[model samples]
Target chain A: MPVRPLKTKVEFPKMLNSERIQVTGKRVQLMATCLCDAFYDDVAIATVQVLEYLGCEVVFPESQTCCGQPAFNGGDWDASRKVVRHTVKAFEGNDPVIVPSGSCAAMIFHGAQIEFEKEADKDSVAALGKRTWELADFIVNGLNKTTWEGKFESTIAFHRSCHTRGTKSSEASLQLLKSIPGISIVEFGEAEQCCGFGGTFSVSFPAISSSMGNLKLEHVRAKNPDLLVSADMSCMMHLAGLASHEGKPIKAKHVIQVLRDALKNIGLIK
Target chain B: MAHQLIDTFATRLRPETKAAVYDGSKKGHEKRTKLLFDNYAKPDDLRKLAGKIKQHVIENLDTYLPATEERLKENGINVHWASTAEAACNHVLEIMRARGAKRVVKAKTMVSEEIELEAFLNKHDIECLETDLGEFIVQLDHDKPSHIVKPIIHKSRREIAELFEKNGLGAYDDEPQVITRRAREFLRKKYLEGDVAITGANFVIAESGRIVLVTNEGNSRFCLAATSCHIAIVGIEKILPRDRDLALLLNLLGRSGTAQELTVYTEFISGAKASTQPDGPQAMHVIFVDNGRTDVLASDCKEILRCIRCGACLNVCPVYRQASGHAYRSVYPGPVGAVLSPLLLGKNFPQKADLPKASSLCGACNEVCPVDIPIPDLLLRLRAKAKQEGVPSPGTPPMGGWAVMASQPAAWKAALVAGKLINFMPTKLLPVPPLRAWEKTRDLPEWRGGAFRSWLKKHNS
Candidate 1:
């Protein structure tokens, strides 16, 4: 079955940010994330565009790659550590690291707490943990900007990925969505429940994982939303994957994509 | 993949995953635990006080337990220690045989469930009756206690009504009170006439030589009052130094467990005191069962011993909400069970090897735990253990392939670029287990951004 694009129409006001956040001339190296790098190219593009719109310099370091969560989650710490070392070195400068996916951001911040053993690597990982932020969180708390001006008219149910809940508070995504003018945040009952996209978890306990996604999608169907949105592309892929196969009406999207479309709608970016 | 375990997960989770049921369970659990925790006038003070009290007990268990045994002995309570489940059951059976006690009445006790005490007793030509309403329902149906505290949580009142009918209780309405009343009427006789009563303690108070039991049902007292031989089986982890410490534990335990301010009936049993009445128990026995808990205490996951068995962790766990207790295939279930079962049972218990992998590492279980056991962290450690021990599936990578693929940036990038084409490959030919699983329910996403290296070269450069 062909994946269906979200059919919700967007409307926008002239101003993008209700209050322009002061550009600290600070750097936010965007961790385009393995998921965004592979499948959701636009999510990565949208993340960069949104950051630049906030007057923040977004850097995509070539050395940056997968955060090694796939291996970390699969209990292959050796693989995780190697990739993490490469990622740590890639994002080495003191600039705050902003990851597009909550699961990846959480891996750097929370998962890093244990993966490193040597003093130097441990210090580096902990420092990275302090600077790392999921994109919505980096936008709202890191930049101190709550409102973004955009034209969005859609009823979308939000799925807060489990790692996002584990590593950081999920209010940033909700706050950012509310900032958009015409966006209707549909109350999906199980939004906080895991979509069961636990990296290797989806594959390992596939039945439970599939059951979890179906449950989440069922909640989305109950809300009867135009789109099912989440911060983590892993969740988006898992949910959209199952929804597309099952021929469910709901389409999965990264919240960043919705925000990006709103930015374009309001002429904040073309 | 453990096909049997997967089937268990699938069948149990399918019906309950409905928004009203799944989210409702999560909501009820979170509300119950968080309300007490958040609204507690001094939540931190309470947690710290309870934590310190438990820490003190666990650290000095060797000292406190013997001291407790001495005190119980002084109070005329026969103290017995069992290092294993078989030993624990033998102790109870030997006592039951010594007293010629055939009918045994029980209260809500997960420890006995851990030891499979009821089945052992039944095999020894003894009848074991569960006096608590939920436990009774579970007993009648020959099912496992799905939730530690709420034994029949997974069973609806209608199902319960049917179970009661099957147990020869004729007809009853499918409401909670109706079923509860029927159980009350039915079990009242067992509690009054049962030759021996077996119950588990909430906390074994070492200082005063008393084991505290808190039950909402009035059965705990009836069981103790009615039997001549009363046996209290308690975990070594349950020891607390002082009786006064029950104030905070009881407060948090009740609130965190069922959202009640306190369970209606909290009884302290020191021994057979004031038992002049003909019906009152004449003798009391205290059984301290190690049952692999000492091994748990010795391990790095020892903090799991701080668990008060409040079932608060079970209340909030997403997997527990989905799979319930039975899907775990262990007497223990939920997030606490996920970590503890693997450690306590060790490698010989093969079914539990995949139990930790059952969770999504969501951290909700730890978030809601009153004692604050880092369940997700412990689960991760188990995942590492499975890998270290050469367990073949569920988080243990095959031949360290992930390490080889992930270490080389060139290989990682090549894999990324090839991910799109891999999606189109013949499904059976895909070498990766995750890829195979990912392909089962949904299509693999296409790599549309091209290899990130080229994009970064064009953009970041």
Candidate 2:
């Protein structure tokens, strides 16, 4: 399948007009994660489109690379810090840093104790951690946008990403999806289980990871959803990879893309 | 060696996992989890209190244990200390030999299993009978208990019924009730005939020097009260400061392990008998088995000692629920075993270094832990130790590349190009186990024409 550019212009939420955008200055820095930058650009674009619809200026910093979770989770603290420092430097200028991927955002948010404790600006790094938000969480809670004007309906199997617990992004995404008209949730057996994409974990224990991923597959397979959706693209990719490998009909998307697709289905985006 | 061991374990993983995840859990954990939260108004506070009491007992064990020993001695109960597994087993053997006891009835105890007590005693021509239904079934089959709490959780009902029939326990149907009744009748005979009773203490009280036990079956009571002599094996860490703490620990234990309001029987064995007492065991011996528990209490992994053996961590753990207990390769399995095994057995245990890395660090175990043991945190600490111990972790090569690429944009962009190119080839042609494993269940990323960074450049320009 070919990748297409996300439609830039859309009818913005008129309710937000001048009153709401001014609250946070409508300024946000987007950390397009390495997974999105390399493999799933559509999720990144849809995230931007979703943000644009919410009336926010989304800045994609080119200097931003990987989130260092791979190194950080592997117990290589020095290398993790080196990568994290560059990321901390990349998203500068006081805008709320929005991450489309929960895994990456979680790495920076939760890993600050080990990532920044020794740094001269440890407090600053910790402050920056507070500013970071996973995209679904940013859209639902940070922006405080509840109802969707556009209608979308499908049986969605939502994979609650592991690291976004503090933000409650997984629950927020479910609530956000419910606002869209006609969408039915297919509750899978292990819907709350991790997608087995724990950065280096998927690689380190591949057989175990693969075994776990298959269990996740069986969970959703029983539900027979129209699509597999998750707040984290990292998990979506893992699930999609498994489904597509088996020639199963299921497709995977980030929760925002599911929303974006619903809008596209109704000709809301051009 | 570590990789091979894990690979070997992975092959046998599915059957046991299928048994637990599919054939098992018909009892419904969903309702159990709901009841646990509903029954306890402040679950977190309860967990904190349980953790606090355990930590207090562990930290002050030296002072408290001697006092407990004195109290038990005054109550006509003998207290024996076992520094090693061999010593613990020998102490029980000496007690049995002293009484000239030939037939022994046993209740479920993971520690006795740890000491290989059944096999040791049976090999010496003594008849050791397991009274617990699941333990009895496993004993008949001459198989190890797959789960600490459930014992034969991996066995199907049909298998249990078949095992019972094969053992000449009569033609009971596969109905759970029928099998349980048959086991009751069968074990009642052993209970009446046995000369000595051996049981595992759920908690050994310091203030009262008593053994507190909980079981669904009433056999534990028989194993204590029906016999002339009774023996209890307990870990040093099982000591609690007061008898009142049993209320808190038992609440967490039953809810977390089996999701019960309370077990069928919560029996206490403190003193042997009064001078004019007509009932209860004439002699009571409580064996305090250290067996590396003190080492666990001394180390940074001390919090794991607070485990009341609830198996809640096992029930919620995605890894445990899928991989099952045998995959863990321990008497104790699941999240608890993953942390406790390496800590208690030392780093030299088979595949000890790889055990911690088996988890995805999803934090499920820590979330559901009754005592609030930071299981995932301990796993990470063990992973660090494993890395330092010269065991090659699968995390190294990819993370090394990820770190280097993430440090510089030029390197990252270059890697992006390489990743795009790599995604085009078949997964087998690609040279990594992670990708190979990824391709087994999930799709490799389909590289679009250009990277999102370049596409962003085009849009912005």
Candidate 3:
């Protein structure tokens, strides 16, 4: 199936780095990661609602699929290049590409570039990388919505996915969440540690993965937050799935889902 | 096939050992973090400088290695070169035979373990004693060192007490001080009576022909004091361009390895002491062992040779914490071992090919690395190398099928629809081993694969 090109020569304002960032043009291309498409559609729905509420037009390119992270991380660059090439064609545009996953966004920005370094598509991937932003980063930095008006009367323990280390997405999630009124952000130990949702790593070493997850959950439980929130669903899936299997299911949601709920409670979105 | 490595990992998953490793490594990680941060206002900057220095030395080995050999030779130190582990071990045996050295007390040298020196020497009727307390315990138990710096990181005090009692060191006291005293007393006579001292060099100064040894127990100092002959087994990658490099690298090594400001004893030897001096060795032998390091240096992952043997990567690794270092089944373990062991295996790289796949690519190892080695990137490179060579990796699913499905939207959509059938099936019915392994502990979310596309299409219209 051929991927239709996105609108051509749409010159959006340059990404602002000033103290006061004004997002003059708010159109963004949504790369709903495969995890959201398959298992967590609500995250995509919430993402759209939250973006729309913040006065941004979100476009979903129909030909989009997985970001080839699974293959790229597993050391199969040949297969990764095949899928990543399709992605380059799928999201070809000047509009800022917003991703809900730090891992997938990093794949587009970093991993894909490494895979295509020797190919003619390297330049195209580099351009894509410049425009790719994780969702919260797009909202806070790209869209310039630092202060959230909606109220949320629940505590959350955020899991900063290990992939988010080299990106500002983790900080953006924290900034947006803390800006909301009535939201209590609880602190936990080993906040920098991984939750063990390392794509193929979870399955390749199940006992170790489960043990690491159990350790993370124990720390999360100690904080006793109402929700386990993160920008990446891959991590949430592993933590929430393990917790459920252990008969102590915790309410887990993507950061956007929580934002959507807050906006809904305040009558900002129907 | 998963090959022999995975079986080694699975078979060594003892619960108690895992716990010991977990506790010891976590404490090390926490302590290293605190010390490094407290000491340096910008620890990462220091790490980068150290990395650049090592990289400079590695890249210009043609200049520095020969310069090192000349300086040491000029200083009256006998310099020998060994390209393989057997040759390296044979040099030590030849030295022992020449001197008719019956008893040898050794310092903690991981490279010696790489060459399996003690076993080789014992097989040749020369008695070699491990003087470092943790290494001493490991040798007594006839076990391989689990961790690079802390050989007994996987052993509890109770286990050590039993091992010591069984070895007739003492009647079995678990107190830390008592254990140390018992081992110290037993090793005291051996150190004084030893005919030769064998140790590893942390770094060799090419400018002055000096070798540095750092130890907490001062056993290396004892070894040097007692024996008239000193044999320093040096890896070819251990050269520093000048003595000034030690100010940065030694600080990093201490803080990264055991969180010490400086190891209790940082002894630097510049050949044998002047003839007027009476206390030090009369002859010094430095053996530069390659043993596949040059093979690694030739590969794209040569940045790994910058490692200072800190063991910080092992402490920070989640897999090492859970599986323990013994699972790696090599002299080096954890992140550094994962990269080095396979390359060292040469044609047998296929034997330990699974080592690279053992990581989650968490990037923690890269971050904690004192010399700023890009360990995760190196691991990925090795993984790609293995695949390019047609090595079979059992646990990793073939990406050929995934590539086909992901590249075509129509096929991907079709797979999504078919994936929902998994919601109706039992978890036990999950066909793939990776999925089966995943479902063993975690529940799968209800499959709503294609819902987002449908919702987006309608909303857009």
- Per-model TM-score, in order, reads 0.87, 0.86, 0.93
**Residue-level error in angstroms, candidate 3, position B386:** 1.8
- Put down candidate 2 lDDT per residue, A166-190, tens digits, no spaces: 3567777888888888888878775
Q: What digit string (tens of lDDT, one per residue) describes model 1 on residues B11-90?
A: 64646333333554576686775577566766745765576566666766777778888888989999999999999999
With candidate 2 superimposed using the best TM-score fit, by how many Å does residue A35's alpha carbon deviate from the native?
1.0
Q: What is each candidate's DockQ, to 2 decimals?
A: 0.23, 0.24, 0.32
How large an RMSD does model 1 have? 8.9
Name the best candidate (by lDDT).
Answer: 3
Q: Is the docking of candidate 1 incorrect, acceptable, medium or high quality?
A: incorrect
At residue B74, give the lDDT of candidate 3.
Answer: 88
Docking level for model 2:
acceptable
2 against 3, candidate with superior TM-score: 3
Candidate ranking (TM-score, best to worst):
3, 1, 2
- For candidate 1, give the lDDT of residue B318: 64
Best of the candidates, TM-score: 3
Q: Write the per-residue lDDT of candidate 3 for residues B398-458, one digit (tens) a residue.
A: 8899899899999999988899888988757766667777777898889999998888888
On DockQ, the stronger of 1 and 2 is 2
